[model samples]
Target: MKNIILSATLLAMSAGAALADAHSVVRMGTEGAYPPYNFINDDGEVDGFERVLGDELCARAELTCEWVLNDWDSIIPNLTSGNYDTIIAGMSITDERDEVIDFTQNYIPPASSLFVALSEDADLEGGVIAAQTNTIQAGYIAETGATLLEFATPDETVAAVRNGEADAVFADGDFLLPIANEDADLMVVGDPVQLGGGVGMGLRETDTELREAFNAAIQSMKDDGTLNALIIEWFGEEAATF
Candidate 1:
């Protein structure tokens, strides 16, 4: 019986060690549909501002890291379930979200949220506004007098406006600015609305050590002005930083 007990203890230790090693290899979760933040390039790999920022953070933290694509709706739940170690997606830091998960210091400062539509005369107050489900934009729209239409993906929200299912789509200015600039048919309307605290890396509440490592890395980038440079590279000079 003693020998059996010892064997069980040894097995548990080995399993624990394996788990530790796996945790050391940070898995960054992102919604590959959000451009200028993260998206799948033509090469079918994660690329964008968050991709670049996440890689630098991992290098500074001395972590072996890999990117994992997750749908925006399930991103947080997956992180809490240990499907990934961190969410480097351009997720805003909000009080509601903080109740469920911890966030690192702000990497991207809060920026304006904009409304885009096929026409400049689109009604901003009473018209239908589409936003990605479970986003701060969705929450903000819900409070506005405008009818809020929620979609699962950012692309779908934009499509809703193009298809005339919604009068306009509201989202991060950084994400929508380039789209509006590129498409002559689409235009940004009304003044931009600033929402949320800022964008940050998401981690499970239990993963305090992992959060600290990322926070330190973020601070390092901020101190050296690398974070601001990357923000401008992807979001242009108008984007808020540090």
Candidate 2:
């Protein structure tokens, strides 16, 4: 009995050592709800733009990566605590976030966008448009004074508009495109607001190696058409903004 216990302890230690050595395998975070960017699919897999981007970057970096679902607002705090090496949800890069965490090269270009159900009564030109709390679109909601509502997730925001709980939703235009396509009643109400924006694999201030790998791999994918292909498939058009 003592021999068996000793062997179990040794085996546990060995596994721990391997996990610690290749920590990258366990170092990824994503929203897992922002569909077409990163979301939990029907098969119970977390995937989408950010998921694929992280996968490619990990492959290029020659490291194993594991993705976990995280809420957007708490994503940074989790990263700061070393809970994740990078965040790859549909997170937009903003100067505000730069102050807290480092981000890699842009993986997705940003666009100002809004969605509304295709009801004849829909009038988002000056109606309420909800956005996920803390997103750039939140500022637009405030600026427009269009009855800004704060939702914890994009899915909720879309639901609000769908059920007429809200008039519209402001978010990443490209991300909205896919949702609109899936919903026959929803449509992008206006031309996208092109702006200086990009989504990156977010990293902690000290995780230089992981940051470098993500940045390098993103550039490689951009140059090789992989990013564009994914964008077209998800957004139904080649994504613009560098």
Candidate 3:
């Protein structure tokens, strides 16, 4: 899930005016830390499902695009400041985020959030829970009987659970599944809780032209079944698809 702080309306207005013109090389922003969505590979290049998907979408939209890595906490701020043209990170479409920026129709459908812990018997409702700062999971935990521990990154949240800093880490099921499967010490602890609408590309409210281009490109992929194929290829056959 996604969330962001509101930037000054005047600043957004100025940036929008400057970006209204057609771009020669549209910049794509991401947090290259979250794996299977976006991450740095051995070659020192951004690699993962979003990297591949973003490139294809750009190609389809006939736009020359470059990738920029930003900290997740500041991604929206940088975008509003005109550091990048769009956010193709694994950002879920939420009204909270929409208050600061616009989003394309979700590329990934609504998915479940799950809890991962050192033990299968970890308390689901009252234990200390770890979640990445500013995420919907963190907000959700704050409302529950659990004590919420916030970390700067997803990896840190998982590390918290592993190191006994918290009872469990709550996060996207897709992001946690591979980790749980590979590690015998960690296991999923409770029933899946569906969260957010789905994942979408984040754009500035002023970039309607660019947003429409990517939306059309995404729709084309869905029409041809290529989007579903890419989903299954990256997230397994059981993964949800449009």
Q: Please give each candidate's TM-score.
A: 0.90, 0.82, 0.91
Off by over 4 Å in 3: 1-21
Candidate with more favorable, higher lDDT: 2 or 3 = 3
Model 1 has an lDDT value of 0.87
Candidate 2 per-residue lDDT, tens place, 95-168, comes to 88898988887877765565556664666667777789878888766877478888988888888887777887
Off by more than 4 A, model 1: 1-22
Which wins on TM-score, candidate 1 or candidate 3?
3
Candidate 3 root-mean-square deviation in Å: 7.9
Per-residue CA lDDT of candidate 3, range 1-242, in tens?
A: 01111222223333434444678888999999998999999999999999999988877766778999999889999999999989998998888999999999999999999999999899879999999887888888899999999988899999999999999999999999999999999999899988899999999999887887777777767766789999999999889999
Candidate 2, pairs of clashing residues: none
**Best-to-worst lDDT order:** 1, 3, 2
Measured on C-alpha atoms, candidate 2 has an lDDT of 0.72
**Model 3 TM-score, 2 decimals:** 0.91
Q: Candidate 1 at 226: error in angstroms? A: 0.7
Give me candidate 2's TM-score against the actual structure.
Answer: 0.82
Please say which candidate is ahead in TM-score: 1 or 2.
1
Candidate 1 lDDT for residue 14: 43
What candidate 2 gets wrong by more than 4 Å, as runs, is 1-26, 119-126
